[model samples]
Target: MASTTIQRSAARTEVEGAARTERPRGAIAFGLTRIAIGWLFLWAFLDKAFALGFATGRAEDGSIDFFAKGQAWLNGGSPTEGVLRYATKGPLAGFFQSLAGAAWVDWVYMLSMLLIGGALVLGVATRLAAVGGAIWMALFYLATSIWPEYNPVVDEHIVYILVLVGLAQIGAGRYLGLQERWERSALVRRFPVLR
Candidate 1:
């Protein structure tokens, strides 16, 4: 039993030593970056839902209107219609255009943005969120920004996907997020992939 006691003490010492050590470099910055990207998605969901005069809340004359009720999703606005129908270009234009203004499409896109943004911000289900966000960005990339004058390929969408993949692979949620607590949950413990 002495050997067992000694081993437990050694493990405790190691854990204590790790706790006293400095945080890994860029840990906080990584978490902040995750939150920022998450907010980007969250803000899009908010702006589209409320027509807060940024991208969604615009008058017919192209003027910004803070209270453009008709432009908001909550007020009958179609979030996917404008881009899917008019803005989609390139070879996939027809495919994307075919999906324009569909209520289900709008619902899916809006809900995805909310889920991804909320997950990233809260640092819960980050891996799933990252994957979902990356796929969503890919769809947007294919829908509109497939062809840019600046380059043959590569754009903000691609960059965002890469960042998301990185965040997921690194478990960025654990850094400043509730992921540690989430990981200990019964559901997450049973379904490790959800972590």
Candidate 2:
């Protein structure tokens, strides 16, 4: 009985000492928050990419393509001109109109959606993804601002972007993601700028 008590005391002391040597109390909590947000991004991408039925509808019914319909809904049935007309005024309207039907414009928009969505969800380049997501949301706001129902002036997108940015800036991935492994590699050490 005496030996068991001594062993218990020693174990308790070791645990206390180890706790004292750990990082800040908030690091683990913050890492968990990062994991949650990262999952949100990943889910968003998966939902849209697979047509798990979001803004575009089901993926299997040939309804995964939301870009064209989104642009149309923002505009006035002329997919390209609608959003621009809503956001641009006077002289800027002409400039925006010129690019409304540009093929590259749609391509850029689609690619941005894919990349930003992928990055945020994967927690790979979260900072870049968050920034890009913000820009995308901002443009969406611009396009839909004309009407309350069409735009609503507020949405979860803003919150998502901010959270993503915060997570990236804090290097949350280093604590709760593959980024932790990536950060320790010789390649990352050599390219310190990657962080």
Largest TM-score belongs to which candidate?
1
**C-alpha lDDT score of every prediction, in listed order:** 0.89, 0.55
The best candidate in terms of lDDT: 1
Given candidate 2, what's the lDDT at residue 174?
Answer: 51
Q: Between which residue pairs do clashes occur in model 1?
A: none
**Where is model 1 poorest over a 10-residue stretch in terms of lDDT?**
16-25
lDDT of 2 at 14: 92
Models 1 onward score TM values of: 0.85, 0.50
| Clash totals for all candidate models | 0, 3
Report the CA-based lDDT of candidate 1 relative to the real structure.
Answer: 0.89
Measured with C-alpha atoms, the lDDT of residue 164 in candidate 2 is 61
